[model samples]
Target: MKFVGIFIILILVFSCSSEENSLEQYANHPVKFAKQKIDNPDNDFSIFIPKNWEWKAPYKENGNDILGLFANSKSNKNGFKSIILVKKYKSSQNSKDLKSEFEYLSKQIRNHSQIEEIVDFGSTDIFNQESYFFHTKSKSDTNGDSEILNFLINGNIEGIYYNLTLSTPQTTDFNTDMAVLVQSLKTFEILK
Candidate 1:
């Protein structure tokens, strides 16, 4: 009986330590803005993630793959919020086909019933690549209001089509998050 109690205590102690280690492995505390580049070994592309941010594993949906980077613990209900989502769009049209490409994207967003407002940010060049940038506010029954900063880049490397987006909740300050997001976007490189 005494041995059983000792064994139970040891198991509890190890379990608590393991949980703490797992949490630390997932999040970086005392957020700081620094430059870090992520190079993909399996693919011919890579990008920089701003300081105070960490990238999560790519998830799949409807036969599509999406990679997300977060500014903080995504599980946190209230925190400095931001996300950079990267995805590939299989298309025969080259990256220079920005106009038609973005038009398709615009059409998709318009289909979302909860989107309340969309603010056009026009076209700009980053990393020598032409991109269309915009902001949208979405109202949902569960999420309330969310401010999304969308970036569509015609990464003219080879025949690959890719787009990167930055989204955050309206509860957070947009100016601060946008600065970090834009800086990271500018550092994107096509390593093909």
Candidate 2:
């Protein structure tokens, strides 16, 4: 009947409009970043941090030489803070290549007691260099109501291997956070 066809057309139109609106929301608002240079003399590199995010350079903790730590000024609705941590490691002669090193590291992470589950793992190219990434869900040390999401990306430059970890409270908008994190990571550069 004519009424049935009209109703179908109206439903299709509104559904399409809603889909377009959702896409437009993301397209209209792009995340911004500011370049943050590392102060470490041994391994020099720069990374783009989210605009207005708190930055701490030359961060060292528990014997780990963290070159930079960037944290969101505001906590998520769950009262968990999101942070990006960068660590530099000297490349060893025994390691074959980035892939091998990444595999070895991934194994270590999988065996870690804090890591509850590895959501995903794969290889990707970053700035024309090979990079590996691991998306993991981990147990939160703070409390039981929240879980932690760890997105670990590893890439190497000449003699230095860089590990970038984006840690955030597991939330419904995690995909959006991950997209922003990847965008910021794309701006990383080794200072000459």
Candidate 3:
């Protein structure tokens, strides 16, 4: 009887955790712009990128913007959440899966903010690559929480990561300042 009680309690705890997670799933993202090129020569794909923002340098190897959206502002200037990253996954990964993985991976960023806002837009194909896109705007501070507006995707190879994070102390019109990174998204086909 004691064992049964413990087991039931454990189940309830796990169930509650799973339910809470599902509720918090991408419910705070804010995507204000999007476009795609499904006519790539090799691999076809679609992506929702930001419109325009401040410009920076390209992503360094093993760094954030692995897809090539030109990234910088790594360590926030004394707790200011500002990070722009882009990269194309090496392996052939489509969009649907990418969207799922992005949520999972965003949690893996070195200084990932605690998601407070999430919004899911409909899914669409980019040329031939299956794409999953969503918007997110965090509402926390650096040490306390963060703020973010993101458009994440998965290119059917490995996995593409495009993210713009706003950490603590963020004061700029982050939305308007992220267009440069957002509009740089380009689609391509995977040659077979």
Candidate 4:
């Protein structure tokens, strides 16, 4: 009986040590970022991009304005790409508040056919601004074996509605990727 107790204690100690090591790894792995400035006359702001990620500035295409685009160089085992896209829209006088906008967006997402599940949705303060966020799991168009993770944050800044999206394959580590992306989002600053 004493031998069995010792064996059990040893197992518990090793398990706890491994868990602590995993947490330490994440805590010690600091994410590096590069600052990106938007030179648009209408919308003057800057945001941080994860170092080594590809970045494309705001541009017009097919009469549509794209605020910014970013993508990480790493791809999941299934070749699924991780990307961040920013879109800006002019807010009208009758534009809805952040909470109302989140309600509308949540309704639309719930009605989408490709959306497998809405994992989480809520409104929170980000960068001292009221923001709405949605986390969803969706069907993958490219790979039937894999699903897609979709995260979106929307807020109105200085009469402009900004939508930031982070999409990645479910195969990637969600916690790690979210930590980096959220850190990048926290760096957003309005210069106007």
**Model 2 — TM-score against the truth?**
0.66
Winner by TM-score between candidate 3 and candidate 2: 2
lDDT of 2 by residue, 99-149 (tens): 776777777888988788676677755544667777676766652222333
lDDT of 4 by residue, 27-74 (tens): 245765454543334465567666667666664332333354444545
> For every model shown, what is its TM-score relative to the native structure?
0.65, 0.66, 0.37, 0.65
lDDT of 2 at 112: 87
Q: What local lDDT does model 3 show for residue 61?
A: 55
The sequence of per-residue lDDT tens digits that candidate 3 reaches over residues 1-192 is 999999999999999765421112322224344432222222332333333333333334563333343333434445453444444444223434565665555455434545555543334443234444444445553433334434454443454543333222234454343433333333232332
Candidate 3's clash total is 57
> Where does candidate 4 stray beyond 4 Å?
1-43, 59-66, 70-72, 91-94, 143-159
RMSD of 2: 5.9
Per TM-score, what order, best first?
2, 1, 4, 3
Q: Among these predicted structures, which one has the highest TM-score?
A: 2
> How far does residue 136 in candidate 1 sit from its true spot (Å)?
1.2
Worst 10 residues of 4 by lDDT: 19-28
Colliding residue pairs in candidate 2: none
- Local accuracy by lDDT, each model: 0.59, 0.59, 0.41, 0.56
